[model samples]
Target chain A: MTVAVDIKNRLGDFSLEARFESAGRLTALFGPSGSGKTSLVNLIGGLLRPDQGRIAAEGRVFVDTQAGVFVPKHKRRIGYVFQEPRLFPHLNVRSNLSYGRWFTPKGERHDDMGRVVELLGIGHLLDRRPSHLSGGEKQRVAIGRALLASPRLLLMDEPLAALDDARKAEIMPYIERLRDETKTPIVYVTHSIAEVARLASDVVVMAGGKVAAHGPTAEIMQRLDLLSEEEIGEGGSVVDMTVSAHDESFGMSVLHSAAGEVRVSGLGTPVGASVRVRIRARDVIIATERPRGLSALNILSGKIASISSGNGTLADVLIDCSGQIILARITRQSCHALALEPGKPVFAVVKTVSFDRANTMSGVKPG
Target chain B: MEWLDLSPEEWNAVRLSIKVATWAMVASLPPGLLIALLLARGKFWGKSIVNGIVHLPLILPPVVTGYLLLLTFGRRGPAGAFLAEHFGIVFSFRWTGAALACAIMGFPLMVRAIRLSIEAVDRRLEAAAGTLGANPIWVFLTITLPLTLPGVIAGMILSFAKAMGEFGATITFVSNIPGETQTLPSAIYTFTQVPGGDAGALRLTLVSIVISMAALIASEALSRRLGRRMDLE
Candidate 1:
């Protein structure tokens, strides 16, 4: 376990009560805005005190309300990267990265400045002041600064909310590299399901300041009953696959998965590279039999395991393709017209492929 | 250098003005910073009262302020009598008294400049530093102080300029004594009062204008340079 939190707090009309344990190196606090995602991480980072409950990271107790123990933020040894970069304007890039190192006890210091600079690709930015850097560049320096402090846990509150699409694309790999290189656990807060799908190993879904669901990233994503339609948009299934082939002419890549080989629009990875493909339930079409001459590029056959539709307009059809589970979002009329039922055989037609833009991107795996 | 002509007495007055202003600026800096921090961050009882008292000299007439200072710090007053007896220091009828009066009159301007700057600092930056294992004192020194440097500089220069031009308070508290308490402004006042004193008065007046302009320009350039380096407006 990396971080464990159980706390309750109230602010005017909003009441926050949450309890969850994170085992993954990169655990995500997944929720919509005002769901207490930031507040939860803030409590973990010691920026906000909990009215009651205990918080511990790596077995060290940060707060214990019953015991009347409260630790201030400075002693918590947590690194927080805010939505804004919040870099010291007076200091240059190198100095900002080392600002926290000066406060860390020597024994706990992580003095791999060379590697941090290299990891973030900020070699040429050391001498430049923060005002001179772009938004994306400032965020990179902020992350590096937090890492250099040797924090026991790193909390990032929508660290990329300020960056544009191109800049977000530019920085995602560095974040991946950071996760791979550092041993410190990360608690990332984000509302974007794409970010949670690609970056998180575990997901904690929050709604209205409460933990709606918590589990492995794959399990949580596939839990149709536990997620709203907004959260389930094109993210119903996360297929773990490796890059099997790439077609430069068509700008496509093929990914090999347990269910089947999936072909999509772009494969940014080399051959034999792993990628996570998010298959939205809505993008899946159900067929009683495999159809021919269809424009859909990929189809997987499986047995219908369950059919759940709380409302008549929409319902989720769970299909077990080989050993992997996939979801199909279909209307009640089609479900009734197709006479869909559990244990029945069917085919899942994926209209398109979506890819998580990381090392594991399957070319055009359904978005 | 033809415009720089000055007699020995005028030169002494110019030097004394610089000395008194320097002393006033230096003596008020620490307290100004402290009060600014308090007004920016403190949550205590009677904070408004403290604020009012700090700005009293700014709103009061210079002579009235000087009279209040005399009432509290005269030779026979509680603070003045104790200091003279124990530390052998005197404030009444001396150059130090002029410096003291000037500092009092200029205190509010310094504190107000610094307080506004401190308030402008982002508290979130300090919180970020705290998360990085920086204690409160460390955060203040590394983040708050450096970020507010422009304001501090502005405050110091303002106080210094005010001290240099101070006349009413200095005259009332210390009297216009040549070679002692007669600063540039006081000496100019004295020169304008007697027959055939026009040349002397003009010389000191020109000197005063040059020094004041130089101080203003120097401060503007210094703060601008520092603001550029720190990326502050």
Candidate 2:
């Protein structure tokens, strides 16, 4: 599925001029706060009318101002999950989940209520009122409600922003399941680099109400310059890996990828499952020679591809390991001390495996 | 038992007051909800003017409101003449005329209560409903209306109580007539004008208090029940 958007909207002093087409199943609109990410998703969902330009998804025109074509939100067949749950307080979980089905024509409805309820693991909550639910449960119900509508495209505007970290962790796996299992294309909006690394197949970088960059997740993730000052620390390389085996003796799991095998402690996922891992550049240490007494377990030998220095004492080195690129950030003094340059052989020592919920995602294997 | 005794005329007055108030509340409900929705959500020009006219009966003297009603709804008045000729409906010096007067006098209270509740509704929920594929009308009916039911009940009770206590407007628009347009308040007023009528007026006065108190309690219980159902409490 392809989502095509070229729209210009002026809200007060902030004028958004964004144009991009993403064919990834899950495309992330990634930016910091006040960057018009939410506004871009709103334009796609038909909640806001654009002053100019056209928007089409899967070859169906949703809005074309010059052509006088504007499908209302209800007829747009697009689902939206807002920052807040926004569930109807007066309706129970069952009714809220089925609300959109009442408006969809009988012949066009494709989602089954039972399947949606099970998909979100909200079957037990069908009778409870929205007010009685916790933050995570409410978001799950909201997702189920939108899915039951069988929208052609889904727009998520910071679905996890309102939740605490524990709640966000609880909802992330379900979202990953949705991205992998559902047929609907999703345009997710978030100000979090960690979320984009874990959840998005493609990323659209927004800055000052414009599309600063757009590319595949791996390519866009390496461009640390595209991140803001605060998010620069979180920028890293994303690698798709599969769980190869379980080291039950040490209670660890081994992940196999093009970059080679890496063992992570405290992983609970079953073997043969696909997982995406993000290795932050700040967490890597480069060794001129392969050290023998090092406590760190992950080490990959590769020739240095390139290096870019940031404004601080740190410089990012790109390592092309078996055709898979891994980024490492080190100080310029170390670079000079080691005489590191392009085509120089070196060892990249991974300090720690980020098994944190924010950096790891399951169930999306590279095709 | 002896002091509680109500003569036939007093009973007729009590019964007539109940009937008139019920009719007033019922007949004005649809229009009250409509106008409340308009005032709360519609973005048309002259909104403030429409709001001022709806509230005219509240601020104007009851006697003035009654006079205006008589001028418009009397047999010789243009609206009255058109209705009487086209639909054979008349509101001149009759019990139905008393109901019309009470409804007009109570309209502002009902609309105000409903409008406040409508305004309190979280518009985000409505927008969410729209994204869920509910059209505007469906969103209002399923989400907006259910959420505002407590206010609707409060408005209905306010209208009923106002209609029950109405005196100046009803008496001026439809002159008091025994066994016809004479409401409880009108009967009480008539008793105050005559000698040896204190006992009868005292009896009707107690009944009026009981009805009004009952309405207040019922409204409270109903809104609380609705609140609990919505998990809003």
What residue pairs clash in candidate 2, if any at all? none
- Tens-digit lDDT string for candidate 1 (A33-100): 99999999999998889999999998899999999988999998898999999999888999999989
| lDDT (Cα, tens digit) per residue for candidate 2, span A1-367 | 4799999999999999999999998999999889999889989888899999999997799999999999889888888999999998888999989988988888878889987776788889999999999999999999989888889888999999999998988888788878878888889999888788888999999999999999999989899889988878777788888889999899878899988899888466767877788888888899989989988899988889999986779899999888889899889999989999999988888887554373335453211
Q: Poorest 10 consecutive residues of model 2 chain B by lDDT?
A: B224-233
- TM-score of the B chain in each candidate versus the native B chain: 0.96, 0.98
Best of the candidates, DockQ: 1
i-RMS values of the candidates, in order? 1.5, 1.5
B1-233, model 1: which lDDT tens digit per residue?
Answer: 66457888888898999999999999999999999999989999999999999999988899998887788788998999999999998999889999999999899999999999999999988998999889999999999999999899999999999999999888988889998999999998887899988888888888878888998999999999988899941
Candidate 1 docking class: medium
Q: Which candidate number maximizes lDDT? A: 2
lDDT of each: 0.88, 0.89
DockQ of each: 0.71, 0.69
Q: What is the lDDT of residue A235 in candidate 1?
A: 63
